[model samples]
Each structure stands twice: as structure tokens, then as C-alpha cells.
Target chain A: MTDMVMYEEEYRQIQEVCARLHRDANASAVLLIDKNGQLISEAGDTGHLDTTSLSSLTAGNVAATGGIASLLKEKEFTGQFHEGEQINVHISIVAQRVILVILFDERSSLGLVRLRVRRASDELSSVFDSLLAKVQQPSTPSIFSEITDEDIDNLFKD
Target chain B: MSFINYSSREINCKIVYYGPGLCGKTTNLQYIYARTNPDAKGKMISLATETERTLFFDFLPLSLGEIRGFKTRFHLYTVPGQVFYDASRKLILKGVDGVVFVADSQIERTEANIESFDNLEHNLYEQGYDLAKIPYVVQYNKRDLPNVAPIAELRDLINPEQVPEFEAVATTGYGVFDTLKAVAKLVLTELKRGR
Candidate 1:
């Protein structure tokens, strides 16, 4: 059976790009999600991370914060900047369907992450949009999706 | 000529700490932050509810020096462990690499620990990542707790596959680095095989 999760390969590709973005921008973590808020991929240390939960939270934040932005008649929120004493989150939605969330410490600047992400968002959307389209079209299976009891069994046996 | 250019690099990896509630996932990152040298880490962000529970997640970034020419860094994250937050957990696991399954060692929290582990596997399958293929580790935290579960039982229940495991007291900073080191090593090792 095909794994229901979409964007695995695309997200994998994006992970590399996000890693570069994190290093270059001096940010903490970077998250990329679909418009529906399904997480596609991420970069940074996940040693203490439960990203499954974080992606939804980030999408929700974007939706709620975006609504407030619309109501306030501010520029529709392309992103959000939350400043804290130690850590901060920069939330940006790309191509309206994907949201890019950046986690950074005080050493990283909101200005820097925002600047780089604006460009990264567009680049990422273009790349992912194509990948999503590819997944929709081919419907071909790769060794990756060949997950089965045997696969799990053999892996565990090792 | 800026020494570091944010736009230059292109690869990003997202990792989430999967564990039961109050298992010190957040505390692990907190301890890392306390010890991390400035310039290597960015801000730490927490999304919390009025009750102070981790409403969403805690995020932090750490630079693991450099290997070869490319810089090896990690983005640390913690999910809200409450069972009701399953949807949130599902979202964060969307795209992840190297997971540190932080288990609460308290005997009473055993059920929570097991449930979360199952949830972690389920979520990964949904994301199309076989737990075996991804860089993985287990951390039996709260070693300092007086009523903690014995390490043997904890190991059997959670670390059955024995990818790698650590004993920790995240709140006091013990075992935090060990856990990070283990995961970082796994992530890098993955680069060798997959990259």
C-alpha cells in the first residue's frame, strides 16, 4: 500500500535547502508546511523537538495571526514575528499553501530570517509545487514506499 | 563581504522531540540553551497556553561545529505531549529527521510513555518515513526522580530496538548533552548512508 503521507521526497529536498537557510541566516529552526498546514519538511536540531505538534501549532498561529492582520487592515500577514527574551519564532506562509516557520535564538535577528525567508519561500514553493505535481502525476512507487512488515521485521532484526 | 550569508545554503532538516507530557523535552532544549555558546544558536521560541502547558512546541537551533566543509547544525523542537494534542503531534512529524524519544521514567507515567511511542511510529508511517530508516534514539529522562521506573523496564518497553539510548535528568542538565550528541551523531551518520 502506498504511504498516505505526501511530499516526502520534496520535503527531503527542502530539508537540504532549509539547512542552508538556517546556517546562513543564523536562525535556530526552519519548518516548511503545506497550505493545509501539513508539514512537508524541516531543518535544524530536533534533539528535543516534537515537530509533529509544532507544525500544526505553527499553521494555526499563521491562520489566527493572519486573520488578525486582515482585520487590522495591515498587510496580509506573510509572516509573524514573536520576540522573546531567549527565543523567537518567525512564521511565513509561502504561495498561500505552504508556511515556513523559523525558530531562532537572540543571536539571530527577525530582520535577517524574514529577509532570507521571503526569498526562500518563493524558491521553496516553486520547487515543492513541481514536486507535488510530480507526485500527483506519476503514481509510481519507489523502494522508499515499499514499507511492509518484512521491512520493519528485517530492520529490527539488524 | 559578510562572513556568513543566510541565503547561501539550501538544505534544511526539521526534527521533533517525541515523548509523553512533562518528559523534559522542553527542559532538554532549555538546558542546551543554557550551555550553548552565543552565535551558534538562535532564539528559543515557546508557544504556551494560559495554563503554561506547551500549547504548541518549543524550538531552538544548535550548531554542532562543522564536519568536512558543510556546517552541521540542528533545529531542536518539542511537542506538547498531552494526548488530546494528537493532531498537533501529527503536524510536527510531517517532515523530520533524527528523533529523540524522551521517555518519562516515573513508574506511573509508563502508559503515557508507551502510548507516545506508538503515536510516534504511527505518525512516521503516515509521513512515509520508516522509523528504521530515520536517525533515531531513546532517552529515559528523569533519572533523578525518586519514583522513576527502573531502567530495565523502561528499556524493554521503549528501547526494544535499541537504536541508542541515554539516561537523563533534563531539568538539572544531566544527560542533555549526551542525548544531543547521540542524535547529532545519528543525523550525520545518516548523511553518509543516504547523502
Candidate 2:
């Protein structure tokens, strides 16, 4: 299994990208989720929403859509939009490893969201590319060598 | 794939419950959801059909306490077990860090159990994961049923690798946490070995 490691530097970059996406697109919120459905970073007004479950479901939706893309002999559907009565969602794959999900209402237009997301996606892709390189560095010290069996048992102790 | 965030002090790992149709994969998740503290778990979401059969998957995000200042969160998922839903099953295994195969112990469902297990292996392989190399465990479920296979026979047939198999009756919550704990421990141990 591939491991996803987020260093402090990458977190700051992702937060900046998300904040810009939220403001520039006039969207309610911008969430950066891993393709595996883990919420990496979130910005904007997500107070009333359940980001955890939303992230997981969004990833599932993307994966299902990607499956459809394969059947159609395409690489992937880069963007998806779901219009709702009050709010709408726009999801896009960034760097092929992360998902950019934006939630907007009548205040924002689909055209604006797409434009901002595309720009932010490119910035985020570079940030993630560096993060991936750092994680794959062979010179990095091991996080587990010092961990003992007792350390693991202590975690599950009731 | 396990996501370790040094910035947030969180470690998120995906664990998928897999088995044949109506073989208690969803039941295992339901038991865990019911037992888990509300503060420690997210809402349980089931993407199912009108008949309540899982259509895509059932998702439960759980926090199993913290370890060394890092919150250990496990995202639990169950793949739809019907043969026709094989596509959905493969999609769910995309970044799985570990698997808990809930094999139906009923005598009549023996073949279904084997087929599902084989399918799991194939799907994992397609996603660039070798089943044997990843953290995994097996659960012989529905042990309370009188028509179930014996533990010894089930172990020989289902758990040839002997990866911490457990006997469970998920509906009653019997051995459910035990099975979960076993696989989670293996996953954490693997992480300690630096992936």
C-alpha cells in the first residue's frame, strides 16, 4: 500500500490554496480530500456540514466515475458538478492523487468556480508533487525503528 | 494507503470488511457503529438499494484512541458482496491498508465464502497491493448457527496463512470488537515497521 505523508510545509500550502479557492470562486467552502477519501485540509464555511462523511462519499463518487471512464476508454472525468436547490458541489481531481471539492450556493456561478478551481489545482499539484518527493526520500529517518511492541500495546489498552 | 499527517498529528488508515452476500459484512460494521462512542465515530453511511442491500458500500470512520500523541483514526468500509457488484468492490479497495474478511461459516455458503475471498485477492492485486503483503485477518462469522462449519475446518479452508483468525457472531456483537482489534493491531504493527 502507498503511504501518504503530509509535512508541515505541505499543510500550509494546501491551506493557502483552499482559502484562495474559497474566496476567488465565491464558494461556501473548499475541501482538499485525498483520493482515498481522507480529508487533508478544509477552508471556508463548513460549519454546518459533515466534512468527514462528505469527503468519503465524494471519493467514492470519483472512484465510481473513474470506473465509468475506463469503460468508455477514457482516462478520467476531471470535473463533476451537482446542482442542488440551494447549494451545489463541484469536484475535480488534482495531481491524480487528491480531490478538490467546492461547495457553492446561488452567490457563486459555475463558471467562476471552474476557473478558480483550475488555477488552484495547478498550484496544489506542485505542492503535492514536492510532498510526495519528500515522503519517498530514502535519506529520511525511519519513524518506526524506535517504536517497541509495548508502545503498540499501550495504544489499545482500555 | 495510510495517511500520516505530522502537521495534524493524525494517522488515518482504511480497513474494508469483505465477504459474500448477506454474510454479515454490514452486520459487523453495524455492531461497531452501535458500540462506538458518538464522539469517537462519524455517522455511519450505507449506500444501499431500496431493499437495504448494500448498493455501493457502507462507510464508518472511527477513532481508536490516540497513540504517541497521534490520533489513530480508521476508516471502516464494507464492499457490496453480491457477485454483480464486483466493480464496486474493486473501487472500494483502492487504498485499503488492511482487510477483515468476514467469512460466512454456514455450511451452504462455503463456496460463496471462497469465491469472495478469491475476488478480494484479485481486486487488491489490481490496485497494486499483494494480499499477503498487507495487514489482514479473517473472521469466521455466524458461529451461533447450528449448520455452520467447524472452526478447525473453516480455519484450514479460509485462513491457510493463519493470520489471527477469530470466530464471530456479528449480529449479537460477539467477537466483533475482538476481530476488529486483532486486524487493527496488525495494521499498527505494520506501520511501526515503517510500511
Q: Pick the candidate with the highest DockQ.
A: 2
Query: Can you tell me which runs of candidate 2 are displaced by over 4 Å?
Result: none
**What value does DockQ give for candidate 1?**
0.06
Give the alpha carbon lDDT tens digit for every residue of B135-176 in model 2: 999999999999998888888877888888888999999989
lDDT of 2 at A34: 97
Question: Which tens-of-lDDT digit does each residue in A1-158 have in candidate 1?
Answer: 11123445555667777988888789877877644334566788656876755764566577556556756998677767888888898887776666888889977787888778877877787875775465456564432333333332232231
- lDDT per residue as tens, model 2, A1-158: 35999888889989998998899999999999999999999999999989999999999999999999999999999999999999999999999999999999999999999989889999999999998888888876545556678877987777
True contacts kept of each: 0.00, 0.83
Task: Candidate 1: list runs displaced more than 4 Å.
Answer: A1-158, B1-7
Cα lDDT, model 2, residue A21: 87
Q: Residue B15 of candidate 2: its Cα lDDT?
A: 96
- Candidate with top lDDT is 2
